[model samples]
Target: MKISDNCYVEIHFTLNNEDNEVVDSSLGGEPLPYIHGMKNIIPGLEQALEGRVAGDKFSVTIKPELGYGERDEDKVSIIDAESFAGFDQIEEGLLCQIEGEDGSPQLVTITHIDEEEGEVTIDANHPFAGQILNFSVEVMQVRSATEAELRDGLTG
Candidate 1:
């Protein structure tokens, strides 16, 4: 069947960056499965897969906005190290959760650390932000979604 909203899709995909570096791929593993219209994948990819059926193979280039989105300078900020007092380790490239202004938990990556200055630079932007992405995809299977799968927005 053709892929459409609420359908279950299995695809083998290789995602690459502008430098042609493979960012992710399912070629060495099992095909990834997801509910077609539940935002399980990036917007550009999901749109490209629409109406495609099993055995379709294609490549798509997705701009930053349709991928991880443009990076916002405001999302990179320096805060007092005391904010993370309880944590034993405070180093660059560390992923941590912090309470946002809205009181919701937000994931942030530690970009820099100044032990003497007692400050930490945190970036809330996605790691792939501001970059174009290329995707090579092959549709392996397409089937009607089971009621449970649709309700859970996933497949077994």
Candidate 2:
């Protein structure tokens, strides 16, 4: 059956960045399963998989807006190093979670650290933001989702 909303779909896919580096892949592993049209995957990929059936193979290129979205300068900020009091070590490239405006944990990566100034620059943007993404995907299976699966928005 063709993939559609509420359907259980399985696919094997390799995700690459503009640098032609493999960011993620399901090759040599079990096919990833998700509920079609449930936002289980990126918008570009899910849209591309629409109407596809098992055995379908295709490559799609997604722009930043459709993937992780363009990077926002406002999302990068420098804060006092004392904010991370509990952490023993504070270094560049360290990833940590902070409370966001909505009271949810937001992941931020340490881009720069000034030991002398006691300041840290953290970027909240997604790592892939502002980059093009390429996906090579093969539909492995498509089937009607069970009632429980539909309710949970997952595949079993």
Candidate 3:
């Protein structure tokens, strides 16, 4: 079956950056599966995979805009330590959630901690933001997606 908006696809892929560093991979392991046109993957990759059939192998480079999006300077902020009042210990590299402006939840990583100043630097941008992506993928399986799956816009 050809991959389309309501089809399920299984693919094994390796992603590398311009630096040739492996950003992610599924080659030496199980293939990742998802529904086509369902935002299961990056926009660039999904668009490239559309209309392809099982057994197809291809490579594509995704610009930052269609990937994780360009980094925003405003996404980084420093907050006083008192904001994390309930935490007994605070350190860098810790993942935490904060309320966004619209009352939605936002995840951020602790990037820096200043003990004397009692402040923490948190970055809300995605880790891969502002970088291009190079992907090599091989389609392993293709199947028609169920109506429920299509409505949910994701794979089971």
Candidate 4:
């Protein structure tokens, strides 16, 4: 069946950066599945997958805005180093999860550690933000979404 709203789709995809570095892939793993037009995946990828059928293959490039949103300087901030006391050590470029303003867990990358001042700088932007995404994808399956799947925004 062709992919359409609420249709369950399974796709094998390899995602790369503008530099051609593989950012992620489902080549050897199980195909990734999602409910079409439900925002289960990025807007660009989902839009590109629309109307495709099983066995279809295509490539697409997504701008940062459509991918992860442009990196925001406001998303970078410094907090008490004590927040990471649970860790044996904290260093630059380390990814961790911290509570966001709404009390939800948010992923952040440690960009700097000031041991002398007890401050840790973190960037809350998604690691993929502000970057172009190049994807090579193959449709593995396309079928009507089950009642439960549609309601739950997932697939079996």
Candidate 5:
């Protein structure tokens, strides 16, 4: 079977950045499985795998827009340190959740600290945001997805 809308696909992949640094991989782990065409993976990768069959191997390079999107300067903010008082530590590189403008929870990474100013710099962009992705993928299986699985936004 070929990977297409409503199909189930199993793939093993190694994702790398422009510098060839390994960003993620299925090494020593089960191949990733997802319902094809359901936005289970990056848009560029999902679209590239369309119509591909099991045992197919290929490499695809995706731009930032189709990957995590270009990094937005506006997503970085400097906030008062007291907002994180509940945390035992306020070290940089810590991941924290803050209330977003809509009152929804937003995940942000601490970037800097200003002891004198009592401020902390945080960035809400995904870690991989603005980076191009180079993927080496091998399709393990491709088959029709069950009706129930499709309804649940998954593949079986």
Candidate 6:
């Protein structure tokens, strides 16, 4: 079977940043499985996988807009460290979610901690934002989506 709408696709892929650094990979592990056309993966990768058959290998570059989107400087903010009193450790690289302007939870990463300054730097942009993603993917399997999978809009 080929990858298409409602199909279950299993792929092994290596994702690299614009700098050619391996951001992620599934080469030595289980293949990632997702239902095609379900928005379960990035738009660029999903579009590239369309009509692909099992055992096909290809490389594709996804622009920032299609991958994680252009980074917004406004997403980065410096807030009072005292606001995080309940947390045990407030260290760099820690991920947390804060309420957004729309009253929704927004995930933010702790980019820096200013000890003496009593401030913390948080960024809401995805880590990969603003960078081109280079993906080398090998299709491992493709099967018709099951009835339950379709109803649930996902793959088993």
lDDT values for all models: 0.93, 0.92, 0.88, 0.92, 0.92, 0.92
lDDT of 3 by residue, 42-119 (tens): 899999998898899999999999999999989999998888888877789888887777999999888999989989
Per-residue alpha-carbon lDDT of model 6 for 20-110, expressed as tens digits? 9998999999999899988899899999999999999999999998898999999999999987898988789998987777999889999
Evaluated with TM-score, which candidate comes out highest? 4
Scored by Cα lDDT, where does model 3 land?
0.88
Task: Give me the overall lDDT of model 2.
Answer: 0.92
TM-score versus the correct structure, for each prediction? 0.88, 0.88, 0.85, 0.93, 0.88, 0.89
Tens-digit lDDT track for model 2 on 83-111? Answer: 89988887898888987779999999999
Cα-based lDDT at residue 114, candidate 4: 89
Q: Which candidate comes out best when scored by lDDT?
A: 1
Point out the worst 10-residue segment of candidate 2 by lDDT: 147-156
Q: How does model 1 score by TM-score?
A: 0.88
Candidate 3 residue runs with Cα over 4 Å from true position: 85-91, 153-156
Better of 2 and 3 by lDDT: 2
Count: clashes, candidate 3? 0
Off by over 4 Å in 2: 88-90
Show model 4 residue runs off by greater than 4 Å. none
Q: What TM-score would candidate 5 get against the native?
A: 0.88
- Per-candidate Cα RMSD to the true structure, in Å, reads 2.0, 2.0, 2.3, 1.5, 2.0, 1.9
Residues 72-132 of candidate 5 have per-residue lDDT tens digits of 9999999999989888888889888999989999999999999999999999998889999
